[model samples]
Target: MAGKSIIDVLENIPREVIYTIVLIAMILPLLRPLGLPVPVSEPIKKWYDAIESLPPGSLVLISHCNLGAYPAFDSMQVATLHHLFSRPVKLVFFSIDATGLVVYDTLLSKVDPKAYGKVYGVDYFHIGYIPGGETAMKALAEDFKAAVPSDYKGTPIDQIPMAKDIKDIRDFTMIICFTSAGETSIGWIRQWIVVRPEIKYLCCVLDMMLPTMRPYYEAGQVAALTGSAPGGEYEFLIGKPGSGIKKADAFTGAQLILLVFIIIGNIASIAKRMGKGGVR
Candidate 1:
């Protein structure tokens, strides 16, 4: 094997074989995760601590604005919901985007609050989707009930014991936004944060939007943030490994395979160049 040219071996390997190996690497993790250790980032740790530090009966407002990027943001949502539900906080959920309504329902179904001993209209309340964008956020900041009269299911806000006392955004101890849209957080900051500066604000955004949010996080506008991979990190931190861990395993495996291929290709090229020179 040492005598044989590495270039010959690598160059002869078919593209189909490479593709099959990559596919297997991705699928095998989904079936049985490798349970890879994901390092918790500072931002994610802060996000976790922000929630953990909250008093048991503290009120939390979750503003979900992700629309078409559910797959990317769903893990974070699920993990956050699990974390929140595991605690004794009173939660009020509302969506700024229309598509977020469906996202909220899907997320709720995945992280069934009832399973965590959370009762509907008591432990948590969903205000459904509000349509005024930044304007709606401003309105909700001033008077929550006036902005949203009913829950997602058409139950009046007053009917939900948890929500009846939430007169405005200031009533909540913390406000967290899980958004896919790049501009959604800005809207929250401008509308909600600006009005109620005392309330701590946290955000979970798509990984791609991390760059756009770093400045906000740095400026103390966003107390904490968890974007993309940090979702898995949060899952790991919370000790509840679900789809995020599985996805992280697949992601790690895929990257390793790609790296191996790149190294092999480079080695094969170098060997080929040496062989040609020796023949000359």
Candidate 2:
């Protein structure tokens, strides 16, 4: 990244004001959450409701496939996890992205501190980052424990309460791929959903991906979808109605700011084209 220079200095002046405005926009709405009925798209609603309805203690496999980024996606990840926790599911977390383990561990700590005692190697497990990405996914589908002998805390699978019963990938009731990347979701669909033809597969991804991933959802490859904070806010508003709702407001404000900037730029360009040199 470059340090501030003349143009950077000029640009940064408005940045602070814009940030404050955005902060207020987000905060005010959250403090008084819009209760905006962001219609839960059927897929997302189904996904959310499914997870919400799970019997407590149901084991869920959460894979972080994206190299965790931004508070929006990260927050969404946490929101998803919180939803899982609310259902009181036993979470088995892993990641294909090298940085994924660190992100999930951090998210767990921040999102639900009390749940930490859910036991690292017992109720909750971290299989750490697996290399070979897609190939590893295929391998795990065959023999999950063989692919990773131990969890993140260095405990053997046989010794762990959850793993003791989970002999292979088929053992998991559902697979939740929380990622911004398509690698895990696509691989799970190919190697697990298609091959096994039993276990449920859901994808929690960034909203920007909906266009491309819609086909997979339509094809029944993904059982459910929850992308971006709008989905998170929708869930939160119904329950806690906290940061997720606020984040949605900030998102709206940021979009408005961009739209204003675009309109101003277009007006300037039109003025110049009309030979007035954008004088106004």
Candidate 3:
């Protein structure tokens, strides 16, 4: 190590070596999570709290709005489904966009409500994709029966035991909307919240939508606000670790490794400026 200055060693780290180190940092956690301390953020806390407080027979409405963001929203939706199914609450599923139906199979396959002993018509139901976007939102608020013609399986809504009693937006004790089309989210507020205002609404959007939607939470229009980023926190709080937890571990490991490289790069740059090498 004498002939090669510290700067030289740091700067000459093989590209493959750097990549391998990063890969290891990411892979180890997925294989065996270190169970690193996960600080629960306020947003995740609020969302978890809302779910925890649901009455035994409370009915909850779930709407997934992102058409092409399964990679982005999968953890949030999966962790949420796990938490909900863990409780004795009922759930109704639908999509704001027609394209979002692709998400149902992926999400349900991961959650597998049967594993939780959830019977389809009794505990939960998926009403499939409703195509009207904001227009759909308004109709849903005024009349749930009119808006949803049949279950996602094509069974008439009236025939579905769990859905038979659902009258309008007012029937659901809480409304949880995953990050979706902005207007569609606002449509829920205008059509549902503005008129009723008692329904507990939590808007789960992407990290970027926090700024725009945070005010709704602050204004007490939305019961709680969360996003895709801190989805792992929900898992931690509920004591059910899944994709969110694994993603959190991998993410933390990768970031720390990148930070070390950043620090080493800065040190090498400073050493050069101080004339440690012959070139300087």
Candidate 4:
């Protein structure tokens, strides 16, 4: 230890210490987030504004299609639902895939619309999973009742006051889909958006799908777009810090720590080389 060079010391940082620091950085934020500021990007800002600008009593349709990978889009869905519930809009949730029903229920439980003074049958409705993929989406666009005759709980749609007027896709004031696959968005675009061009469309998709949808967004087919890391940004913009905020805080802390270590290591290497007359 006495003869060890500064470079050696810096490069030999104990794996245990690094792991411990990283663990603390992640866990602390989950327990008590630092409330760090997250910058709002154009896409997320657009998504927020689209919801904020909706008129009261406007009915919204949300399509959930990523059931197996809930963790990836859970924060986005929660934050979106929280924002929607905060407004005067009526929401109708449906799934494109069978597994999406489980994910939808999980998110509903976590967001707890009841806490926001929203009633199940009066303020919001959940129609559960509808199979047939593109064909089902087309049917829903033309005749929602025929596509989904009952709610997720087997209750007739006619019994739900909020769903009484939702006859087809055009009945919705806005359409928002959180999907992990391109087919989900493409189906909506072909069956719903193309048929009813007036209905506003917004999507929250995986980061990789951004390129596939960017052209539509640019052409005004999608009023707003957000995905992946932008979920945290949306949470920040909404001023309702949730899991996304905590995750962002931890991510920022970890990156900062990594940057600091990189700087120190470089400095130590340079100093050691200078002491050795630049031989190394």
Q: How much is 98 displaced in model 2, in angstroms?
A: 1.8
Q: Poorest 10 consecutive residues of model 4 by lDDT?
A: 271-280
Provide the lDDT at 140 for model 3: 82
Query: Model 4: which residue pairs collide?
Result: none
- Pairs that collide in candidate 2 are none
Which stretches of model 4 miss by more than 4 angstroms?
A: 1-36, 253-280
**What residue runs in model 1 are displaced by over 4 Å at the alpha carbon?**
1-22, 65-67, 257-280
Which residue segments of model 2 deviate by more than 4 Å?
Answer: 1-43, 55-57, 65-70, 113-117, 234-238, 264-280
Quote the RMSD, in angstroms, for model 3.
4.1
Per-prediction TM-score: 0.82, 0.77, 0.80, 0.79
Clash statistics: count for each candidate: 0, 0, 0, 0
> Looking at model 1, which ten-residue stretch has the lowest summed lDDT?
271-280
Where is model 3 more than 4 Å wrong at Cα?
1-34, 65-67, 254-280
Residue-level lDDT of model 2, residues 89-141, one tens digit each, is 78888888888877876777666736544656656778888889789888877
TM-score of candidate 3 on Cα atoms, chains taken together: 0.80
- lDDT, candidate 1, equals 0.84
Candidate 4 residue 230 C-alpha distance from true site, Å: 2.0
Task: Please state every model's RMSD to the true fold in angstroms.
Answer: 4.3, 5.9, 4.1, 4.5
Task: Please give the ranking of all candidate structures by TM-score, highest first, separated by commas.
Answer: 1, 3, 4, 2
lDDT of 4 by residue, 197-249 (tens): 88889988888899999999889888888776667887788887777876888
